[model samples]
Target chain A: MPMNAQKSVLGTLGSRAWITTVWAVTIFFVINLLALIATVMTSSFGTRWLGTWLPAGWTVNWYASAWEEFQLGDLLTTTFEVVFAVVFLAGLIGIPAAYALARREFTGKRIVMLLFLLPLLVPPVTYGIPLATVLYKTGLGGTMSGVILANLVPALPFVILVMVPFVEQIDPRVEDAARVFGANTFRLFVHVLLPLLLPGALAALLLVLVRTIAMFELTFLTAGPDSQTLVVALYYAVFAAGVRAIQSIDAMAVVYMLTTLVWLLVALRFVNPTQMVTRAKRP
Target chain B: MSDTARNHHLPLKMRLSAAGFDGVTLLVLPAILLLVGFFVYPFFYGLWLSFHPKDGSVFGNYKTFFSDPFLYETISKTLWLSIPVTILNMATAVPIALRVRLMKNQRLLTTILVLPITLGTVLVAEGMLNYLGPQGWFNRTLITFGLISAPLKLVHNYTGVFLSLVITGFPFTFLLVLSYLTGIDPTLEKAAATLGAGPISRFRHILLPLLVPGLAVTFCLGFVQAFSVFPSAVLLGAPSGPTRVITIAAYEAAFEQYDYSLASAIAMIMGVVLLAIIGAVLAARSLFYRGPAGGGKG
Candidate 1:
């Protein structure tokens, strides 16, 4: 009753609650950012920010060490290679499938989408292990081909997910017009359908690239010694790299997170991330 | 033409449709085959491995997984970790997402929130450790505050793993849920208010029902994503105590221990359980969509 009595000028508990919630959220953001800043500063300065609220000085000691000595260059190249291959392959496969679902009527149209989602729904552990086993036993385990194959399971699904809407958004009659004019399926796709879907395809490519680049779980489990990814390398640095030395995981964390953040920003900018598909209206 | 004659024409169209489909299928066959061969086969095979054993019998591996308290802890711990992390992610992402979608400045706010989606799980886990781990900033701050006598233990613990999961998972939920929110027609809410419905009523009657399907979908997607999470679990999760997840056990079995049968079994269990839940949710959403406003298409 007293608390209710304390309802001030607005005569609304909801506003009060919302205000409190917003402030609470803001506090969360501040704390998280502060923590992140703290990590970066500590790694950069090799010192705490207690007395002055910020570090007195900064150093590039870790960056120099990471860039110069660490095999980050090689790992980065491998990461790029795998991500590029997966994106290209997924687009080629995804475009045709998406065009079909969009253009034609089929007996089991609904099930096709479900089938597309199958790879995504299946647990990573289930496939990653067997794939790793097959690759290793077959001598492709640590090879680029092996990593690229493993990456496809997830990347391709992501491609299909983004591509479906793109396919759906193209004017249905355009393809029909092409068909009437004697354009076969391949020409229609190559000229008419492809141009319309290309934006969506590009969006899908960006989406998959973001997902593939940042993904560590599958890469970690399936990657072989020579094929070890950047994330995997980062993993060893924390656990197997002698925790006491190696200039603190803080520096390494900054490097990994910052790089990922930059790439994601680029991806999100190109793609209308909210819609998940270019030119797609709400269904 | 009679209805049967019309239906006869429909079959022709359907048959003709196969040509188009075949082309599409041919293109996507590699991915589809890969999914079937790698994911589906392994899934059933993993299940088979659980029951049929390589060492001696099928039940033996599952018995090891279930009977041994250690193996069992992985499952329970994984559930525990997943529940909280999923809850935290949905809680933060959904409401902010709701508000963001309703606001004019959606892009700017969304850009900030979605930044973490770029950062991989390993990077996030590593970042959390660097920030929260012993000898990290938080401890240094506490020391400065005289709050603790020594640097606090943070990394390689439940707290570290949970925090990392929250950071990584929240952005995804926020982005997806926000998109779902944007799709709902705003005029309905305006009409509700015009007809004497309060904001809460508009939300409950109009918004909540619409949000139901999205909520269920987002929840399942987020939960499974969290459940299958690996990098953070290995990097930040306490291997022995406060944060060991089932994925870790499966990894160790498959890779470290060279026990494919056992690994497959564990993997199978995970796949089945996850699929079962997703399947159940999809079925529920489909049934609920019997009305005209069911989802437009897959």
Candidate 2:
């Protein structure tokens, strides 16, 4: 249908009430969300902000205090280490598995696919307790490696799920042609598949990076003092709130928000957020 | 025997490949092993731990959890918080997604909406404390506009937790519904319009049926996310009161009381409740039209 024709049809159908209500709801939600974030951002720089529309004074000292109080320098380094490790390891294990799952028809393929789905289906906290217990027994709990391993449970499956659709989209004939020209499996993947798969892999890993950064449950359950990610640290800071200044805490929040927002923006450039969910939903 | 000997003469890779474990297929092993070693094993371990209590018979933890109102009430508390929030998020998401699907600037709107999801529950909770607090901008503005005589008690209560869940969860629900709505071809609605069906009837007869399955899925996913409410419940909610959710109970059992067995039991119960709700929704989805939602060529 032509756009104007559809519009005429819609307009004549007297659906303006519905459209108006939707826009009202959406505007209401967006305005509140932005205001909430703006409140946090404004407070992070405010000198005093009690019972007032705006702060008495604005300063940047909270950032410095938050950095010192929260040990943010070390916290950021740990977060980056854990996030990168998860991204790297998930890619290494997940991409090839995705390729295989996408290309091949083998016995128990359904079962294999279900195995991947379960981790994503089950919330991390449901499993994180026992996993933490097991990690503690193995002397890995409260350690960086424990956090990394705990995170990979969801991250690896996410990578595989996201990459499967991407892998399936590749032309089989391309792989056949590579094989016909004397390419072995290794050579085929390296020379042909690698380049073709790069975009999808990067998108998947970038998403994994963003998810790992925000993954609080598993990281919180498994992390020790030194292994705590930024989100976990923020949770602790919030939970134990009396000692730290609210301004400094909001400053830490702004830092955390900026970190995730930067990565999310980068990720959105490569992938449509909605399409990613839809693709992952595919059987 | 002769076949086996001949097969044995080949490389191990080839031998394995003959049984359908080809080189490509074997790539899946590492991921499987990781899941097994981490996710699968731990789930069973938790289950097993739940059965064996530290101070009593095998069913001690379960008994304790059931008998204690404090522990058991968390179930109802959590369900009360999660179910309504999930329903509200999906209810709002459906209409908004329907609206956004027709708009020209869907991507920009979606990106803006998606900010909450990435900002996460903790940040949202933090912001809510300040934004919706007694002395915060929200109240000040409302009061300035003569909306209320006094600041409404929003944070550190059930209402605060509810707001936090909606703020963090609505984006996700919206995105999922939008994706599903977009997947349904616009021509279906157009066809209904051409046939002189009114807008409401066209939606009732066409879009509503197609959207049911997707709505069920959105409900389950959104419910799962909300049901696992942890940080928001603690930070934005009165954790010792109305928001003493199941996860908090489990955390207290494990960390505060140093009773891993009871915690594991609570975790297992949480999983079972979550799955049971999801299973019921999915089962109900079968009653609806289950064909391809899309009108386009696959």
**What TM-scores do the predictions have?**
0.86, 0.94
Which residue pairs clash in candidate 2?
none
Chain A TM-scores of each predicted structure, in the order given, are 0.81, 0.92
Kindly list the per-residue Cα lDDT of model 1 for residues A25-135, writing each as its tens digit.
945764785576456546555544443445656666766666655567787788788888988888877667665566566566576668777667555665787667666
Please identify model 1 stretches exceeding 4 Å from their true place. A1-10, A30-34, A45-57, A179-190, A241-255, A275-283, B1-25, B139-153, B275-298
lDDT of 2 by residue, B166-230 (tens): 99889999999988887788888998899999767988999999999989988998999899999
For residues A69-122, write the lDDT of model 2, one tens digit per residue. Answer: 999999999999999999999999999899889988777889989999988878
Per-residue error (Å), model 1, residue B9: 16
In terms of lDDT, the poorest run of 10 residues in model 2 chain A is A274-283
Per-residue CA lDDT of candidate 1, range B107-164, in tens?
Answer: 7666655666566566666667657766566677788889999777777778778777
